[model samples]
Target chain A: MSVREEQSQPAPVEGGSSEEFETERASATPKGGEGCDGCDHRATKPRRKSRLPALNPPLETTQHWFIEAITHPGTIESGMRKAQKIVGRGRVVTDGPILDAVDRMRIYHYAYRARLVECLADDYPTIQYAMGADRFERLASDVIDALPSRKANLNGYGRVVIDYLQRGPGEDGGRVPNRRFYADLARLEWALVEAVHAAPVPALDLPALQAIPIEQWGDVRFTPSASLRILRFDYPVNRFLQHFREDKVPSIPRAKTTATAVYRQGFAVWRMDLDLNMVDLLDALLRGETLGAALAPLEDRLDASHVMAWFMAWVRSGFFATVR
Target chain B: MSARLGFPDLGIGIGLRTPHYRHILDERPKIGWFEILSENYMQTEGRPMMILDQIAERYPIVMHGVSMSIGSTDPLDTEYLRELVRLRDRVGARWVSDHLCWTGVHTHNSHDLLPMPLTEEALAHVADRVRAVQDLLGAPFILENPSTYVEFAGSTMPEWEFLSRLCENTGCGLLLDVNNVYVSSRNHGFHPHVYLDALPMDRVVQFHVAGHTDNGDHCVDTHIGPVIKPVWQLLRYAWKKGANASILLEWDAEIPSFDEVRADALRARRYLS
Candidate 1:
């Protein structure tokens, strides 16, 4: 079901005078109100009553109150109940009637939620396709409730989904089917997105690397491109993503260790699956290790010819920003 | 008619969207100008940015954003403004614009343009922010009237009055989105014509025309499909009132071919001419 349909309608609250409602709210604070309520202090602070003192102070006083109430990270009905206490009844008026005012607030509340969900859907298209529209939207809504967006950019909004899913639905008190696989998929997808938008760096051309003396090869350290990302997962997410991109409904493969590198080349993002040894070498190179040291650990396990081929392939793929 | 800010009317243009990127580059159709979503190309080194560089080289571009949050109580984001200035300078944008509403508070971004209370207090607050932004940008900052679903009970005046006073206070310009005016009017039961007539027509530097989804009693500003007759009528009304601002068609969802969207945008010329 759509989020709008899933949410229950807000019930109208009893109308009261501003002073009467303020006194009632202050009394209802549970005296101590024990320990923070875990709400963000910045978000839930009491409205500043002294900011504006007009004949109708309720409207001026309740401006931020209404915004905070509707965007309270809770159900719409609860938000309305909290907003009602701050503004009081019969004091709030709009160009439209009171009922329209209530409906308008509801629309804003739903629109905020809808936009967040839309961002998540765009950032994680593969996961959305796998989970289907309804299920993916439900998951997106739940993730949003747990971790509201703190950045001005929507592109940076859903970075926590992978970790959130890894926590195994503990918050929801339910098990998500194939939870591990889904988490891995989210990791790969998000990594690609980050790689695509990361800072651009000029790749070190083959001639530049060849110009270095043979004696300096041992001390030469390679700088990985800013758009390079090395991801390790327990599911074959790279293969799954390939099929998903091809518009085929492929079955989820059995659990298997998978290591992949995602990087941008010529303004296009590319993904490559690598063996365990190659993953280790790439990881070391990404950490600013010398070419000699990056290959030393894999020397005994792999043939010399294979190592040289891998090195040449990485350079051809434009993964190194510089070689010094 | 020249805008008070002296921004030239670049004639009818369309929003540069992703689906039409390949077609735009390959065909390079005859167009007046392009309005780019500032946030889309900011802080990115992706294909979108590359394509924008190519497009900006040939077309007149304007930067419109949603994250400026001008009405928020939070301190202005200097970093966002700096990047906006850089992007504007890089693209040689004619003007930079965002909505006259807050996107979030307390460092959180709702990504939706939330409504503002139409009061003297909000007017002063927003005017100050607009002046600061314009100073930082070293250009005239333009603001579009958002398609608001809710009207604040605390609003002491109509939206048109608040906008007019804001323009006067800040010396900023207006984008005058006619579809948004129509959408808000129907949602709040006001006359769209009165809303347009109340505006300072000379201050309008641009115009936005888009389609919306009409859901019985209320309408959602879904930039899909074609511009409706009522909204086109509103655009015509604004045009006759001497708002000779640059007109751009917005189609963000279910986008058709470039030819189709261009044709849709070209429809405005009939009313303007």
Candidate 2:
């Protein structure tokens, strides 16, 4: 299952009902519902009342509670209540006047949200620019609420964002303007990010390609560089990103199929737009089709000169790792 | 002071931040070393890794990580350790270090160095993980004290006691962040000196000095701007007590020119000399 689908499942409540947990938590605190002010002085002082009955829930349950609290989009109090249900209020004790267990949880909640938003913003700058900061942060928060980060590296956190956007903003309970354009922009940005970090590969040298016999050229297969990525979008995302980088607020172009290839060469990332025929040829090559087979399908769609020019461009761009 | 664990006192260094990359590559300034955030270069084969490769050739580099989550309840992530060792070997890092706190529970990563409860159970749990990490890396794993905003009621002892005991148990070394010592002391209402004094000097292999945001009631280890007066004093104190440990200044936010940040890191020379 996709990460989005997996995360959509309701968080499991481990052993007991929420009602029973609430009752136990209520009984642990003072009848007046006013516990110690969560003061450091109070923490140091001996507790007159026996420590609230410890609830040693399973480690996963505690972790779920902790993660749920930080990822929750509701008020801090609601997040705290969720945490208190699993770990008990006593487990989150703090030593400050203004900050209680709930307040401490709130601090963490904000920190987590900030980190997520920062990661998303860093990874998808074009989307952030297109959506504006406030709207982008809201969208980012919704994404975090829906899908808590599942990877150890923050770099791996936002790959599912494009998928999340495709599922539509309805899951986030808010409507986004230019949703399709925004999604396309996100795809473009993520593609560039992937291209930038993709593993390095040695480009096919000219001598190796030239040594192939003319008859065997038809049967030759090509391996694309690790950083090569082809993205097809409804909008001219390649041009949009270019305009965005130039600091000109270009109007979102009308709906048109645009295919772009992003790759890294000499430790620098580069992008280029491609025609439908070229996209088809590259896609065929990516699927491990022989050079003749990949070109045969496009024979009627392109002339020999155009095919030769595109092939030379691809080679010059260092798109292929091996030609055999 | 004698160097501990045979790790050299690489003198003063600054964190190799992105903002200073061009200047660092161009000027090749006279700096002691550069501390690379391991996670920044671990999963990427891009510009950052490329730049790191070039920088490693010029300077003494050490690998510091934030995602080790050493104190988490989850099992050790061997994949991360493997990559860490690879990076350490690639860069010829002198040591690999991460915070002595968990980044998250479960598999989810909050990416913040969340504090651990200073209980005996937690101490044992963290020590075992550190030992495993050390075994995997085939080197003494260094752990740093994180700046915390809250203290758990479940804590059975002070932070220093837990760290000291953990070092004793695992034979791991410490990266004493004086700024974190001061920040946590203020937030938790303890004296920084008392916490510093309680630590075993011989086990300390490094020191971190950084600036923080003073929020009236507490300070946050923001690692921005300049290192404050008190934190510098604490650095001097740690330098005197501990052996000649490598000291690094971290400036992650609102970074200025390379010379300015390097100058801030160079201030440590006055105290060390």
Candidate 3:
């Protein structure tokens, strides 16, 4: 099952009559205290009467209502209310012998939320660990509810988490702690996901660099790998991430401008912090600057040896696919 | 049992997941085939494609998707379909499969396989879409029965009837997931055998078997743990019903090691015998 199909369904009902119309309402009623796993809200309350009309709705109308009901940000009843408002229905779904209409619909409602949370959790495990499961789930739910997926694939869905956290406090019920720091952390994590999914390219090796005529180096424009990403942050979230990966929950540090490079080598994803001079040089080169022009801005800050060391490091890091 | 459309009955297999990637590459496990989630490898040309390039050379890979939204009223996504073709050609995949349900409507993808109302309107709509998809792929498009929770109040016929008619109308193939059938049957209070009996067994090109959570009132297709006795029995019954299709196991959550998943998948061999 893909992330979409991975939503764990609620437990099945026991044996019942196979007759289509046989309404075993006694056993079909949802048992009390039963909630979907990881879902805080359960449909234990008396469900409001169905608002869907008895007549067969058109396919478009049915889908619109169904999408609204399952994708509702709140409880299943609230989703139904939202669906009713959108499509003007009474209950369109049949209450089967095993589960009532509301209980049945709750499965999808909870599953949709659970599947997305799981996908984000996979990509942002450090954040999940930092916020604790409940808090992280709430934040993810808020992000998911706010930004419904527009693309067919979910690999890029977590892209919105960065903006969500940076949008400021009181926006998400204050569920997020250290909004700016978490935003940086999400940015770092999303970078890794992007790096892995990004196209892999061969780096200009030492021989390739040597092959480039030194006299022509001034005019050579370097081509960065498609997976290369240079990120600047107000927090040292990369260090925090390293600590978290080693099972050390370091306190979120104070804000400090940190420049980092995220790129992949073969199958391994690498993240390296950069100094101000290096950041300027790399940023210039990434903007299609030639060697001489890229270093001209940092000439005062970078000596001959400094340029040599940084160029060697960048070459070894597989950041540049070609320089010509 | 001959395949309906010459699709091979590759023996019991497991889904190609991330955790097992390293093991699959290092050991080159002796498995029948691997069913890949097509969307995972689509829209990206990174390590997944690199690894898939190597794996496809060694194994018979099948493409199972979740985002096609075949039953939606919205117009089909042409780019998505083109990418599917590109990936199928790139991977040399045995076949491409998605759910029989819709994902979302009006340009929004809920990402969850939402159920479709079993009505004449829906059946015809799906049939037309199936034809279009098949025409684009130039191959028989295979669809699996998604595990649905709610049945529409206005359903004019059962799901099996709808599937049978859809297959009859379009030259599509079926990836009969026994676990899904068992899960949906339990949820809807229908006998699993009754549901299987209604399907055109000859059209089934594959069978999906996996464990599900029995939540007392309804069975959720969690695809966790192992193949329970009943689900394997369902597979056995389907096999006995003459749907000689390939067998694939999907263990998405809490996935164990390749060897463990292989052992769990091999459990189907006994039932098939």
Candidate No. with top DockQ: 3
Q: lDDT rank, highest first?
A: 3, 1, 2
Docking class of 3: acceptable
Model 3, residue A33: displacement in angstroms? 19
> What is the CA-based DockQ of model 3?
0.41
Runs in model 3 deviating more than 4 A are A1-35, A39-53, A168-177
Q: Who wins the lDDT comparison? A: 3
Candidate 2: the clashing residue pairs are A40-A95
Q: What are the models' TM-scores?
A: 0.87, 0.88, 0.91
lDDT of each: 0.74, 0.74, 0.80
Q: Considering only chain B, report the TM-score of each candidate against the true chain B.
A: 0.98, 0.97, 0.98
Residue range B48-149, candidate 2, lDDT tens digits: 677789999999998888888888898888888888898899989999999977777767767767778777777778888888998898988998888877
Q: Model 1 segments beyond 4 Å from truth?
A: A1-63, A72-75, A85-99, A168-175
Better of 1 and 3 by TM-score: 3
DockQ of candidate 1 is 0.22
Interface RMSD of each: 15.2, 13.6, 10.6
Candidate ranking under DockQ, highest first, comes to: 3, 2, 1
Q: Report the C-alpha lDDT of model 2 over A132-166, residue by residue, as the tens digit.
A: 89888888888887777766676667776776787
Each candidate's DockQ score against the native complex?
0.22, 0.25, 0.41
